[model samples]
Each structure stands twice: as structure tokens, then as C-alpha cells.
Target: MNKTTWAMVTFSVGLGLSACGEEAGGPTVEQVAKAYEMYMNVNLATELGQRIEVRGWEDFKPGCKSSGPERVKCITGGKVELMGFQGGEQTVPKPVSVPAEFDLEFEKRENTWVPVRAQKK
Candidate 1:
């Protein structure tokens, strides 16, 4: 084969390998976004003085650097249960530690949403 052809082949192979290695079966950025969304939702509810609870959870991204386990809990006498997904971002970007679980409730006086509690599992 020509030198150019062999070089092209080698480059292509290297690129493919790099892509696979970067992913490394870790949690995706999307997974982290989802967890943030859920956490926000629960926190909104808790601010309104509503009850909250959590049970077991599953990690969306098993090996993701920013992905961790999520727990599902029953709340308000099973009226409102929540599953919280954790983002593994440490003290680099975000000012607060990544939450392991989130409990949200509502406030009757202000009719607003708030976070009742956040815990690190």
C-alpha cells in the first residue's frame, strides 16, 4: 500500500479508539442534566410545605464521572414519592456538594415551591 494510504488508515483507527476510550461506559452529560431537573422539581415541592420521602434508587450513569446513584422514596403518606439522581461534580464548578437525595415540599402561606431537605447518601 502507498505511504499515504497506510497513514490514513492509522489515523482513522486512532480516532475511533480515542472516542471509545473517552466514553468508557461512564454516565452521559444528559444523565447529569436529568438528575438536576428531578432535584429541582422535588425542591420546588418542598418549598410549598409539602411532605417528602425517598426509598431506593438507581444510578443513571454507572461509570460516569458526573453520574451517581439515585434513590426512590415515598412521601406524604405515599402521596408524593421522589427518586433523586446524583451528579458527581465536586468542589470544582458548583459551589455546593452534589446531593445524594433531595426532598421538596410546598408552602401554603406563600404558595411557593421549596426544598425541604437535601442529603448525601
Candidate 2:
């Protein structure tokens, strides 16, 4: 193979290895919050045929002073606009803004974090 082709192949292999190594960390606080928001939205839609418009989060921080590597806890305040179904057959739309507080616990499973428990504060 030509020198240019060899260099490209070597770079590609190194890039792939780096990408694999990058996957070995747990999710950040923001990622956990996002996931929680998504979970809430999916659950609401499935159970009540409603949807939430996530405004944002506040006071997001680690729940414990020194949480171990395996388990993590986080607390945050979230704002969401809840859209409810109204009228006949729940076909109408009514949206209301709601603020919520959350305490979430996660466990590091392999390379990802999974929420083990969640509660509203």
C-alpha cells in the first residue's frame, strides 16, 4: 500500500480505539436529568395520553457528599408545561406550567448509568 494509505489506515484504527475508550464513563448529571425528563414524558404519554414540554432544570447537583463509584444520587428542580387532554374523547389540548423537584438515584451498569429509583421532593 502507498504511504498515504498506510497513514490513513493507522489513523482510522487509532480513532476507533479512542472512541471505544470514551464509552467507559458514567452519564453526567445533565444526561441523567435529560433521561429522567424523557422517561417522565414517555410515561405520561403512554398512561394519560398527555405530554410535557420540558422547560429546564435548576439546582442540579449530586445528592450525596461522597457517593461511591457504583451508586450515584442527584437532586434537581425541573419546570415543565403539562399539556392535558380535554373535551370529548380527550381530544382538546390544555397546557399548564408545573414546577417539580426530583431526587434520583442511579447505578453504574457497565458503561452507562441506570436510574434505580426516583422520587419527587
The candidate that achieves the highest lDDT relative to the unseen native structure = 2
Give the Å error, residue 90, model 1: 32
Work out the TM-score per prediction.
Answer: 0.23, 0.48
Q: Which segments of model 1 are wrong by more than 4 Å?
A: 1-23, 45-121
Which 10 successive residues of model 2 have the least lDDT summed? 6-15
lDDT of 1 at 49: 40
Report the lDDT of model 2 for residue 93: 48
Global lDDT for candidate 2?
0.45
TM-score of 1: 0.23
Mind giving the per-residue lDDT tens digits that candidate 1 earns over 75-120? 2111122333334222133223233442222111132112222233
